[model samples]
Target: MFEWPWKDIARECELYLGPAGFSAVQVSPPHEHIVWEKHPWWERYQVASYKIESRSGNEAEFADMVKRCRRAGVDIYADAVINHMTGIPGGTAVGGTSFTHYDYPGIYDFNDFHHCGRNGNDDIVNYKDLYELQNCELVDLADLATETSKVQNTIAAYLNHLLDLGVAGFRIDAAKHIPAKDLKAIMSQLKRSAYVYQEVIYDPAGPISYADYTPIGDVTAYDYAHRLGAAIKDKKMDGLLHIGENFPASNDSIVFVTNHDLERTGDPYILKYSSEDQKLYRLAQIFMLAWPFGYPQVYTGYDFTNYDDGPPLNEQLRTLPVLSSQNQCTAPFTCEHRLPEVAAMVDFRNQTDGSFVVNNFWSNNTDQLAFSRGQKGFVAINFSGNQLPKEFQTGLPAGKYCNIVGASYNPNTHSCPNMIEVNAQGKANVVIQAYSAMVLLNRTTASQKKKAL
Candidate 1:
């Protein structure tokens, strides 16, 4: 699913992302980053300038993509890498911009960066001290003195330019590295209310806290990921009934199963699609999409055994065109967005929006879960290794509804490849197999099913 040149991603917004009911596409850092050998993915994180020209495309091309995607009813969430500059000593960046470590021309100079110690060379070796986490270089990457007004203005300008280009929001990368005061100042200066999601890996033992950043924007729910990962990995579907139990409430979280950083690089917290726990990974996505929780994000990228493997590309290192056919997957790219279950859940989520979960059904076995999002929809997921057969009170009027999960829905015919019937009493006998999900939608009436579909 690797599509470079902002133009290609825009096209995907229409074909794949938009059609799949996704509201936005979280893109890589558009800024000019340190170009590395073989075009590793992290090179984009090591930014030299805020110019929108890197492996993806140039400024004009990026602007055009933004316009096109907006027309397609999909928004763009750009990864803002403002925490630090290239970890490696800089040269001319991918966009032909000249730079040196801690000294970006016309942008940042030696005084702009920080050092944990007075020497301006200390790496982050401790998390106990708040200053060390906020002021020190993260993983040897040159840290920015974001508290300074000069730095705040520069970052604001960079972000505002993206706003002018019609970007919906930003995912502040490595936000924990910058102090909360500095982040507040930078966000306050932005002219528009761009949707902000900060990347602060929550830690109870760490000096910085997630609560301080939640006032600014949604914080990445790593705690949710860890709990969900454990539940799925241990086959404890019962544990997932209260998935968002301790999270920062439903409104203040960007819940996801796994992200680019967690799936790759050092300190992976979950098994990726390439590993033996692939089924659990996929199942986790299903639960996230179905359950009425925080805004859900479905991650689909190139599959790799190695952590440093970049996007799928041709001989020129230019990314290959994203294709629709599964057969076209040259590399091990796990395009989970295209899965039938995932797509159907998107429909389920929309139909059940603003509806709360009720009529829960689970027992001691707890391998099976059945719940309704008010009367609008009903869903049952069976995560046990064996097939399950059970009857539950669906809480819907007598009608025939299509099972969107195990089968496809035909809006034109108002028919389902497979259908389920709820009797007059709102009781339905549901049979689900291992690692499978079933959905019955009430809003999808015979006449309006097309709209829901």
Candidate 2:
């Protein structure tokens, strides 16, 4: 969600994208934050209090947005930043809430935090680095002492409020910094109203294991994002096959191409590195959405030359409106989610309902990758330099079907930009273009086993 009030935006989202299958909208942090006149946009991550008042909107507007989104069958997920509070000192938040370092009378003070500093670094001196990360300052921000009963109550109350508002889940920012035990405590306190996903960027070899966060909720599969991006950039089609193969079978993860923080912090490894390779980047996203492993998050970004620059804003510093009427993005927005192939993948995932990836996977070892979602749906991707001939195993019921990824289907003639007629043997001869993806659904008939010969 943007910084502006969500009433109108949520309403419009429901109007346009809702029909296109957007079941959820992840809003920015809804807490109050210390607003700096010089860099107002930085206020997003800096938390002052758990109150539902900030650049996004006030309490009433937030409630209204939730109601409207839920009414449209879309759920709201909050970006919960419980790791730290505002970094600036001697200043009230935009909501006029006052706070001080080592002395938060309204909540708790620094003494209430877990203090264990090897050096005299007041910034974070405590739970053996883990405690400080959770209870001390993060980038000079006032860290919440989640270990304390008072702090836990406050955080729990705030989360409960959002849950009561009918949010679907949460995205815990900087979760790797926070201790797993404290996170479990916080999770135990909540009324189980929403799902909790922690941000643990685990590489191939990391100090922390994803299993730590799995006890609480799903951990972000940051490695998957990096690997996918790398494969796309190198044009290493074979490397792309290794995607999701590395993910631990036991733990669930949230996979995404990019997020607000990564895009803002200029993570060269992901987007910046793949800047010159747009086709590959898009193909990586397609494969991610096609393969069933973790919960997939599709990013809709605004084009920016500078990484630190905020979303398209007006002179007043408020986020400018996003135009989705033309099925295209304008005014510096990189609406990758609107692409026909990407949108089709979302639809495919929704239709698959997290089924196992059928092992009958086929790849040309060059550009084409095809797989079936058990018997529900079939997908073929063409990433080669040239168009592919009409040939592939779709694993669908024997019948004629329309390609949902191409042009919209006309109910009258049932004509679409792409069509396939599956033979009695449950195979489809699919032709796809370079840098394109095709998905076919067996909406007409169910996949039944062949009779014993």
For each candidate, give its TM-score against the true structure.
Answer: 0.92, 0.86
Q: Give Cα distance to truth, residue 251, candidate 2, Å.
A: 7.0
- Among all windows of 10 consecutive residues in model 1, the one with the lowest summed lDDT is 444-453
User: Which of the numbered candidates is closest to the native, going by highest TM-score?
Assistant: 1
lDDT of 1 by residue, 70-111 (tens): 887778889899999889887888778999897888899999
TM-score for candidate 2, please give it. 0.86
Candidate 2 regions with alpha-carbon error over 4 angstroms: 2-5, 37-41, 114-136, 203-206, 248-251, 265-276, 312-317, 323-330, 408-418, 445-453
- Evaluated at residue 343, the lDDT of candidate 1 is 72
Kindly provide the TM-score of model 1 when superposed on the true structure, using C-alpha atoms. Answer: 0.92
Residue pairs with backbone overlap in model 2 = 116-125, 116-126, 127-131
Give me the candidate number with maximum lDDT: 1
lDDT of each: 0.76, 0.68
